[model samples]
Target: MSVEFSVFLIAVAFIGLVVSIIILLRKAMATLDEANKALAEAREAVRDLGSEAGSVLGHANDIAAQVKDKIRAIDAIVNSAQDVGQILHTVTDTARKAVAVLNHTPQAAQPEYVPTNKITIRKTSIDALAKETDRI
Candidate 1:
């Protein structure tokens, strides 16, 4: 072959190789841009999930506060129950003492008769008595 023809062929091969390399580089750049966009989207999704998790944690804290309040209320109820038990014990003791006194006391065989004073008066006398009582 002629030297000029060989040189021309080498120059064409080099140009083709450069063009291929440029095409490969552009494809790689496009893929990298797509990957960057996907990463940004993933980061945004994680941020949203974090906000949702914070909201859930706040709700859980509210529930825990409510449970604590209920426990306090239950404690108050138990204290009231203890007070009621003490009152019942006092009442039971008094009733037992009264029963013992009644059982030990002797009953009279004959019932005593008491006379009530009777006043017989005219209507005028009743009116005077009513006036005197009213004054008193």
Candidate 2:
């Protein structure tokens, strides 16, 4: 072949290769742009989620604080009730001890047949209670 013709064919082939490379580069650039847009959208979504999570955490903290306050109030009530129970138990124990001591102590001899009282108490059934309201 003639050298000029071969040189022209080689130039044509090189131009075609360059055109193909440019076309591929354009496609790659478009893909990169799409990827960038998707990444931006994902970043925005993540930011929104972060703010929402912060709001949720704030609410949870408030609820926890309220629960703690309620528990403290309940604990105070329980402590007061426990104190009252202890006071009642102590009073009952003191009364029981006094009764036991009184029962164990010796008593004086009874005087024989001294009638100075004017009123008397009697126990009867409901049939007698109908006629006698004073009997018990």
Candidate 3:
């Protein structure tokens, strides 16, 4: 009777240990499932951040290109201004030379003296005198 009772007690203990092990495994599986869900969420957030970073970089590149174009335009304007300044200086120099030449040119001199004379007339045949006067 003692031997039968000991065997029954060992069988009961073995069943309890198996049940405990199954419960612990179920809890562990639940924890692993929660961790997997959190990992998936983190990965999604990282992907979104990467996409936003790419957009920002693209905008920066566009701005850089626009700035480069503006700088080139400014350089061209400056060169044109320099050319205009040189042309203006040349025109000014030419105008100054023309004014100097005009200032130094000679003028025609007026005659210094003039004489006054009187003439005498004699009576003659009327028609002949009229003709001679008309000829003079």
TM-score for every candidate vs. truth? 0.69, 0.73, 0.58
- Colliding pairs, model 1: none
- Lowest summed lDDT window (length 10), candidate 3: 119-128
How many angstroms is residue 27 displaced in model 3 relative to the true structure, after the best TM-score fit?
Answer: 1.4
Off by over 4 Å in 3: 89-136
Q: After aligning candidate 2 to the native by TM-score, how far in Å is the CA of 94 from where it should be?
A: 1.7
Query: What clash pairs does model 2 have?
Result: none
lDDT tens per residue, model 2, 1-136:
6999999999999999999999999999999999999999999999999999999999999999999999999999999999999977766565555444434544413323537775222232233433333321
lDDT of 3: 0.73
Best by TM-score: 2
Off by over 4 Å in 1: 106-136
Please state every model's RMSD to the true fold in angstroms.
Answer: 13.7, 11.9, 21.2
lDDT of 3 by residue, 13-50 (tens): 99999999999999999999999999999999999999
